[model samples]
Target: MSFFKAIRIDQRAETCDARYVDMAEEELMPGDVDLAVTHSAINYKDGLAVTGKGAVVRRFPMIPGVDLAGRVTRSTHPDFSAGDLVVATGCGVGEAHYGGFAERARLSGDWLVKLPGTLTPARAMTVGTAGLTAMFCLLALERHGLAPTDGPAVVSGASGGVGSFAVALLAAAGWRVAAITGHPAEADYLTSLGAAEILAREAFAQPGKPLQSQRFAAGVDTVGGVTLANILAQTQFDGAVAATGNVGGMDLPASVAPFILRGVALLGVESVRPRIALRRAAWARIATDLDAALIDAMCEVIPFDQALERARAIVTGKIRGRVVIEMP
Candidate 1:
């Protein structure tokens, strides 16, 4: 058939570069279904992949996008058919395989989740990997016996996509939200998303005692390193912290005092390789619990060509909430 434009990353003389080029459908990876991509969203991982900032890409000349939503154009899988709406996130889409960020995609039917009745293609991407990560974090907290009535839950890195979604989801679930942010100007924005309190990054990012005064009953931490250590230090007895992102740093300088003395739980949330059952459950919860109006207010729609710009913004913490790319 005809060639289509796709963003590709190439390696030359030990250096990596990203560019958009016209490619044939035959270049796509083997999969059971072919999709006419409608929308995709930028994630922190996507930023790393596109910018070559982290070890996000394992091969040269790759397409980078962690999440996509669209209609099926062809399928070998019995459960999926032409014209069926589908969403796929994680499952190594952008990292180990050629992914979205193109007009068409080939993906395993097993990786696909049919869009719920409550969500359209655009809205599905609006809740992309970031929102799904938020859901996974919240689910982790819930599994650890954290309840809304327990007390306030802190959301670290509150201005970013996952953090913003965490704040809104926790609030909607009837938990008081304490937003921790470096951008003081986003306090009002955090408040609008249902954060009851805004804590400055300076107040929390500093190195602190191994054990500090208990604060949150639970927490969803997107910033790792000392930020996670501090959250662990201050979490209430028997409280749980879902640790997701490592934007702050990967090394966690922490003491065992919290876990040994207070019984605090450190739950690691990895959305990329989550079990199919957990992925389905997380999406179901998101479909029912997320506030659509609030999500709309928090999301920014961008043309597909601007995905790179949006990815850079996401990596630099310049973008608020989610950035959805309209593909067609």
Candidate 2:
């Protein structure tokens, strides 16, 4: 087993395509830890990078998986040793660095986090970057005084990987959840995850009014721009909204009314390049906070060969929940 397979993305004449290819361990980018990846997860950003739809890949000839779970085969770093289960996410992996699209990944030891025995490599990929982002959103809102007693938390983009996790975790934590989605047909699915109510994305996507009737006490928003603006406009006084994505649009198009009149707070949540302590804490929480059944229900395991097609589907909103790519 000297060589392994990976989905390699290369650019030529302003175009790019991701394809499965055989790769040697020695061909990996410089790093201290060598891992045999068991699973990798596709994210919206990875979709953009793999499909060349957005400027997600600054360098050509990259591996386009942002999150992975595996076992350490070799490590010089003091914190790790042979046969340790681990997971790696964020920190520009699958982007500025060659990442987990490969069955083999040589990564900076600094980026590796040991997975607790309670977590399996496959389950770790189910959480991946999207789950971590969802946890960060929950924590941010919590810090800003979000509690189940305040009101139901709203999750925009409810069918997304992050959104789905948010719904399940919040429910497990005893918070009433309202899932807002463009796909109304997913109401039953979201309800099963503990959403007390479901709102149509059409109504939720409308332009902001500076201030609107109070709705969610706290919210995790994966859809930005107008959707974010509206959430802020309607968030309860002193409530918080953690904004994590710009899928709808980039412009905020909002005002100070919500900030001043309502005293609502909008927290920016970024998982990539997060402080080491926060990252570790979030992963530890995910290991316990996420319901195992929900994780299993939301996760779909696919062969590494399907990475390209899955990546395209992710950014196009065709994917529901998380997509994990099993290494060959």
Candidate 3:
């Protein structure tokens, strides 16, 4: 049996710890394709899984990385062959199954997508699941009749992965972007991503009256709880808000005025279980719309062994931009 190094989380004396361990190919979960993983990115959920901060991992001794980009080494699936470049995000790759923290990965072909011509393996992982979620939100907003000329779109948690991508994509699409974030230091970073305005976290952090001043035509909210509810209340009449992350909190304290009187649409964006067609479309759009230089500016590459430390930082909001783990 061939052994490889993988970052595995184990329960030791009732305490969960994550570390790199030797693993064998036979120990990997059942799958049709085996990949030589070159890169993976750390997101908030990945942070949770690595640190055991939340109920993210359903199984112990698990490998946790939600996004992976690599080359296929072996494949039983007819659509894929050896040497094909591929990327996998969501579909339980890092959650229920072994993820990309290892030098190799085995996964169902159904969870894999051939890398788009516009993106390299490194760049794809730079975008990772967060960018995918951003693209999903953009598409949802567009489908909901949001046009570039509609008005300024607000992006909550604007300094984070999904929020940063949302700011860039929306601005690239010709919509003025107002980035809302708690990190004042990231204002310049957001502006460089095309955010026309940077809003302080206090703008939407506190509890506000339902249906307050209608400032934004639409919004892409990556923070749930009060921030999301405030965004809903502040959306212009006939506008919509795409709610993606629950980093702030899960409970939404909102009123019916925004839905009935203001006619606001709160569309949920879930990238994990998206249909294959939607996933393909979103990826294609990302390959075209996402700026590679901007992505590079936002990405911080680290050695795979540092994944656990980086995960802790991400969970505590100590890191900025995206953290991509380079596999051996």
| Best model per lDDT | 3
Better of 1 and 3 by TM-score: 3
lDDT of 3 by residue, 37-69 (tens): 999988888888878888888887798898999
* Reference-based lDDT, residue 60, model 2: 74
- Model 3 TM-score on a 0 to 1 scale: 0.95
lDDT of 3 at 249: 98
Model 2 residue 40 lDDT score: 92
Which residue pairs does candidate 1 place in steric collision? none
lDDT of 3 at 93: 80
Error of 2 at 33 (Å): 1.1
**lDDT value for candidate 3?**
0.89
Residue 169 in model 3: shift from native, Å?
A: 0.8
Q: Write one digit per residue (lDDT tens) for candidate 1, span 60-136.
A: 77888889999999999988999899999989898888887888899999899888788888888888888889999
Best by TM-score: 3
lDDT of each: 0.88, 0.87, 0.89
